[model samples]
Target: MSGVDLPGAIRLVRANNVRALDPAPAMFEGMLRGWEQQQRSRLLARKTINDRLSLVRRFAEFTGTYPWDWTPEDVEAYFATRLSRGEVVWSTVRGQQGDLEMFCAFIADRRYGWAKACLEEFGRAPVQVCHDWNTAQHVAEFEGRPGRRAFTYEELQTFFDAADDRVEQIRKKGRKGVLAAWRDSVLVKQFYAYGTRRRETSMLDLSDLRHNPRAPHYGRLGALQIRYGKASRGSPPKRRTVLTVPEVDWIVPVIQEWVEEVRCGFSPGRHPALWVSERCGRLGVRRLDEVFAAIREHADLPAELDLHCLRHTYITHLVEFGYPERFVQEQVGHAYASTTALYTWVSDEYRNRLIEDALQRRLERGGGGTLMPQ
Candidate 1:
């Protein structure tokens, strides 16, 4: 495979080759290139490609060959290694397994003639070995601790107040403070107020905003059309979400200030993103991280309170306030009721209060104790 002929030969192999028997290194490289091309055309972003590549590299390293050589046993062994390294989170382990399984399916689709039967044979095999292993590990690690951690209303209020206070202080400093700090304050407010996912917040364009006529007299509600979410791709088929009056009231001013004052130098024609970097011309995940770091620094909140935590907080508050679970699920765009249920963690105190209220109501209705019971 000379340098001049390598590209052509690789293209030919990707177009015509299928059998995995006696697979050459060039063939494997060609397959990888083909996979890259497929991902690109399918609009699989770089972050996704990097994650799949990382998993593929790990599998290749374990098997001492390309991912094409992986068997069902190889898959199990790889996860076993993860367990051995003390990664006991079921969700995390299951996620890695899913990535590998998807990769296997991709390879099989491309190399159907070579390993179609073998792939089909193992496709039905349980992939939950990793999940089970991680579950056991989680149980053993947290043996004495409670199954779930539920924050009290007071605690929730304290966290939000602290975040809000920090934002106000940052904003008071004007442009003297870091641009990233200002950006993060906006994000924290958005997450708490709107219950938006990190990716949703990141993908938001200026054009998503609209006026809501039903906002209360004192405040304004805004409508946001979320076209791209986890379930779909390519910014179409948008769903409308009504932002609360308070959230709209807070975000509109900040956005206006950012556009007119802080963002005055950048041309709206050239840069259409709602959020932009002070240092770079474009904003992205890196900018999002910077915003998060600022929030973490100023709020004195726990390290676990990332952007996603805001969404969790929003749902938790809603459930605690007696919002219908179905309504909450629809607002958050959750596909399953069970998945939405995970966010509704009520504290023991609240549950006890509800029980007390019910007992009081029963007594008030003249439902007597032992002697007077009907």
Candidate 2:
């Protein structure tokens, strides 16, 4: 079959056909193209597919051979090179191995015809070099650094106060950055208030706001529609509605002030983004990190406690505020209760309250008396 008609590894009409040049590199290029089509067929995100293709190319370049000629030694050599150089963190090794494994699996599959094609061209079929013994095991759950942690309530308050103070100080001095400072302050609150990731917060738009029927008091700020929640492999961005709990209900006025007053000053015009920039466009994720870092430094917070820690803090605070595990999961767009549970590192005060409440319940059940003998 012609490459145009065929999908995945079997296509030959392109450079893969090798009418003039040496067949090896041409065939390798074809293999990548086929794998790309195969991944696209599964509806994987473009960036995800691109990253995988790049991984396979890097592996091929390192080995100085195409997939058909790869061996287990090549895989070991590749892993060893990266590990020795300290180029990536330990968790990153597992991800790189997974990408390579997926690519080998794609080419080795008989249905894709890569194996048969390679055999006819080079007298050998492509084989999966990544195996159980060679690959890193995923034993750890949380791979984040030890220093990246949820802010204590006091620390969080200080950070918020610092951001708010920046806005006020700018306004008092009549500085040009007053609007930017005010926007940053509101943006930081939005991060903690909604428990949103940087990209999700960056993607927020004015139209994403809606009133929750159960909480009319919060009005249009009762819930936020997260259109770009992190996607699963081969899936589009997940969408969820995070309702404003009473713990973060203060955000109602904050959101109102931004939308009703501040955001418009950016001259957003037809732009619908909730966070507009000086250029009258939606804010980017990098800008969010820069803004958070600036405020965090001013507040003297831990340098390791980055923007994502705000998410951890939000989840922890929500759990402390007596929201059920499942409710917190939904609010944070976690697919599993366990995932949400991982984000929760309840404060000592909350844990102590739990102990007291448990003992009270036990007393109520046991004739309202202490069990200890006098």
Candidate 3:
């Protein structure tokens, strides 16, 4: 048997009891591989492919059935049990459903022959289980937690001051990690300077620092060439250049100081990461969140104010600085103007000022002194 031709032996065995062989597992594996190949052909990111695969496996495990046996009821019951446990959020459930939908769509597509394979092996095939009835709806432009909002101007000032003070306090005590402290302090400033997501910040390289012709005063730090902007479904990461406008140009000096002085103190053989760790590697996304959390605590800011709040603050301030909506959208690398608007959390004072300016313009136009409710 050990020396027998494997394909011949398999054929002889299948001729006897194909059902006894229980080919469901092997058929499922083939379908998964086909789905992965399809995703790869479509140029989906590796992480995204892995995430979808993991979700499919989890759903199968939950239902005690293979993809061939999955039904809409299984999907609904899985989510129901999850929600009852209070372990997952609506957003997370929505993402899981999206992943499952893509997987099921792949297995059900006749072009892939997964349906034929499943039907021959187990007498059934996978079908789409995710639908609007079992999934969350995108009702509002803002689906984020209610507590997550942009930092106010005063709060932003306090947060920055706290970061700066930490560095100063370390230096005054002749601490060994003053360079690290200085790096964290400047990194937080850079986060606000550019409305960058955490992973986007982590992927920055020295060469990404570019100069904008219109912002000569900012020198080589006038813009950031973001090479790893968020990718759409089945697409590579989107790339964009975020310019340092005059309003946040003050960050130019801070970044210059970090690159010229403090970053140099790190291991010289390290990668060209904008933020490097003491271990001579690029700072990771988790470390970035930890740094922000520490600074936020020291600043006595709201516990709910995560690093994303910095991005919100940037968008809010840019609108207050009178930048055009289109320009803001481009700088933030948002595909739609409405997406950029979602990040903006302008202050009440800014809204009042806008109202005042509107009234002034009306008076200048001699509108018979009509006042309108805002």
Candidate 4:
């Protein structure tokens, strides 16, 4: 790497005579600010920067020592405490350690001059404390909760029935929130119909619905232009368009009814949001979770199944529906096919059908020979 200028306009460097009543704490805060600036210049998102900073602060508090005195032992102790409490999974531990590693790299870099400043004042300098030996290994692609899974076919139908039934139940009482109840019903339908993540579903605008030339019967509801797809680290939200599949095409009329009739009842004058809350123009991601939770409870579904399982349900159904895996990957906006595979948990019935089909094909090839054991 080319030599970087000393101090480099970061907030860490100061005059020799500059001092604070509490110099250690002051310098620690300055180092954090300088690290924040470095990450900002890389165009990382605000939440990403804040999360990394928060992790470093927690580590420091746990160790009761400034960055300059941190050691590999402190890293082990801190994470061991978290492990004892089951505070994080393996993937989360790895990410937190990576954050500490990056922070150490920032302060220790000669270009920033933080080490020089710390050495002159405290006679100590920060060194990278998180090493391969002490950090969590990234051996598994999926480390999510084992109980979490896609909804079963019966469970899927029951949940939808519950959401739909709630609307009429509200109307029967002649309640004021009937319009809102209707909105939630339509929202639930779109969730399974499209398989969007919560934030992506919440961020949808009326303009995101588009006309498909080949699927003209469905009109503007034929495709969904997902503008806020999930992104990888240090990147902006991704974008993809999900075409409506024939199996879930029944949602076409449900969405159309919401837009053309029930949505106008919300009296949202000029808001472009497709899912308009009764109190707000656009529904929020948190509200999406709350709505799903209420419906799942009402239906008495398994506690382990969550809003994201609607997405899992979509992926599994598509795989069973025999769409090409590439097509399924594109519809769900997964960058890799392996990621799409991780979301799928096909039902035993689907697996049995595959076995039956294979046996039938073999029997036909062998002219009905029944004694073949290869």
Candidate 5:
């Protein structure tokens, strides 16, 4: 279709097609327009639209029918196809399911009749898919396979140490290398320390950091105001989270050094984005995979760990350290306690140590410890 005729063509298609009642196309179109409008408003990055469109196209292709005609069976079959293609893991399927559900809802709202029918037939297809997907993820987690590996604390530490060594090597290579090296290190450290989602971290601007005016020794913390996060319904519905002291201490210096020494005399205006790229101008989630890969190469670490694992590790560490469940939930910005709990895996050694320590402490407190009467 010609660019000028596209809208007219879409209108004609909508008018003639019974499936147009499905609302999926209209809703999808609206989303496309909304994304464009958002880009015009500079409220969203263009890449966001690109990414959403890519997923929307994939969903459309997978559904094999218009939105109005979509059935729960289609969703099931789509996932089945993915599994047969060796994409059986719940995480991947779950992510695609979320995208599809969003698209479905978008369409359903506009085409009430189709929406009602689909909803009645599917009996809340999205919710069911999400529930099943999560269950599958848990099953996969418990039944870990060879390719899916969880990192031990030692492995994590080794990776960090190797990353540090690489940073030193980069510094020796001079100005640009030094700045880039430091930035990567800071990014990696911040990922682990804050347990931040990749998008959240990428969205960070320089102003996101709060400096303590009262104390001279106080450093900048990666504190995000509620205004700048992924929120439901286009509003910041969740509370803001503060990065740990370690994250603050670790990242601030590197950032300051980069700003003062390397980014010297350069300002990107009021933008507080901490991460930028050579070409993309701003960093986003897609770029994180490359960053992780680079870090893996430098550290000689296995490629299993992704950016999300930092957040997972942070949650696991918090649980291991005796932090209250609620506290970890708040720190990680989890909407639900159960979501936070998924990341925590209690090791047998730690469990035994906790029991032993508790017994010893009880004995000291005159509770008779292990010899206590039943």
Candidate 6:
């Protein structure tokens, strides 16, 4: 609002005949700078802002046209080409469409002054090219790859056993990584025990473990304060406190052992991170993945089973543990019950047990003596 409008500023430059070999590049640079400034002012994360900008740049490259010349047909053709390549999935296409629409909408907004700038300089302005008719629809709640499922109960046990065995094997061989092996072992245990995402786990500090008034039996480990939770659109990181559920309360001792014994062995006077590297820095998500992947390989799990499968395992196991759906949803910081439901994969044994319980309930109510025909 304080400076001359961007297009007007560009017009003044062109009128001056500064004699640049190519004025278009300069004009485009100015527009991008303005757009990025606007996005940053909205408090979007740097990664998200970059992603949106990249989408716009790719669209321009694909169409070989400026934003002012873009049309809905251009959007359709871009998506058509991406789909034909067989690399983009439905959800990815939908996300790309949404990002493109947001960029176009920003430029097209009258209050933003971009539309006016483009209209005056180029005789046209960018329009919302990605429309409902051309965009991918949100048809299903769960569109994750089919191979990515919760680890079965037996598999979960084997995975943890393998992690523990790594520590023992290192100690037996007089290897150098006994402490590091122990740390990775405990880290994987806490990952599933708490149902935390990689970033959330990476960002956690010792101070994040707090006491729950209702469950004081667990003392300082009664709850986990998640500081780097997944954020909502246009919002900062969301924070939530995941209580130590009765079932996963076993992690209380695991965290206690790490805090009391193993962690103290790390370089003293370091950062107050619960999980620290040998160099006295907080463990990052990439290292966390390597830890899980190594254990998964040793356990002979499928290649598709990644660290995120531990989260899926947590959600599915919670359902089998008979925690209320709403409680499970809240524990995992899901915004919606449907999103939580999407993570659940009930086991055949759990399903059969449920059927048996229903049959017993009917017998107690005197509603049946023999099995009913389907």
Model 6 steric clash pairs: none
Q: Who wins the lDDT comparison?
A: 4
lDDT score for candidate 4 against the true structure:
0.89
How well is each residue in 1-374 modelled by candidate 2, as lDDT tens digits? 22344458575325453474687887787778888888888889898899888888888889888888899999999989988997877778888899888888878887777787789889998888888899888787776566778999899999999999998888898879888999999999999999999999999988899899999988999899999999997778999999988877889998899899988889989998999899998899999999999999989887988999999999999889898888889999998997887777899999999989988899888755556777
lDDT: worst 10-residue window of model 2: 11-20
* Candidate 4: tens digits of C-alpha lDDT, residues 158-258: 99999989989999998888888889988988999999999999999999999899999999999999999997766889999999999999999999999
Q: Please identify model 1 stretches exceeding 4 Å from their true place.
A: 1-23, 34-50, 67-71, 86-88, 102-111, 116-175, 178-183, 216-220, 232-238, 245-271, 279-283, 369-374
Candidate 3 residue-wise lDDT, 1-374, digit = tens = 22343221222223324453557776666566667766777788898888888777888889988987888999889988998998787778877888888888867766555666567767887788888887777776676678899998899999999999999899999979889889999999999999999999999999999988987878899899999999997777899999988878889999999998889899757488988999989999999999999999999989989999999999999999999999999989999999999889888999999988888998899885665787
Model 6's alpha-carbon lDDT is: 0.85
Local accuracy of candidate 5 as per-residue lDDT tens digits, 1-374: 11232221223223333554555456456444533443334443555546666766765688765555556777777778778898656575665666566545544442323344445544532222324543234344333234543457887878777777777877676545555555677678778776777777777776676654443454665443433555553343354756444433555666667655654323445545667665426777887767777877877777777667777777877777777888888887877897776677676777998998988888888875347456
Residue 262, model 5: Cα distance from true site in angstroms: 3.9
Per-residue C-alpha lDDT of model 1 across residues 203-233, encoded as one tens digit per residue: 7676766566775442223656565566444
In model 4, what lDDT does residue 256 have?
Answer: 93
Cα RMSD (Å) between model 1 and the true structure?
7.4
RMSD of 5: 7.9
* Superposed Cα deviation of residue 28, candidate 1 (Å): 2.0
**Number of the candidate with higher TM-score, 3 or 6:** 6
Q: Write the per-residue lDDT of candidate 6 for residues 263-286, one digit (tens) a residue.
A: 878874658888899888989889
Per-prediction TM-score to the true structure, in the order listed: 0.69, 0.91, 0.88, 0.94, 0.66, 0.89
Q: Which is the leading candidate under TM-score? A: 4
Q: What's the lDDT for candidate 3? A: 0.84
Task: Give the candidates in order of TM-score, highest first.
Answer: 4, 2, 6, 3, 1, 5
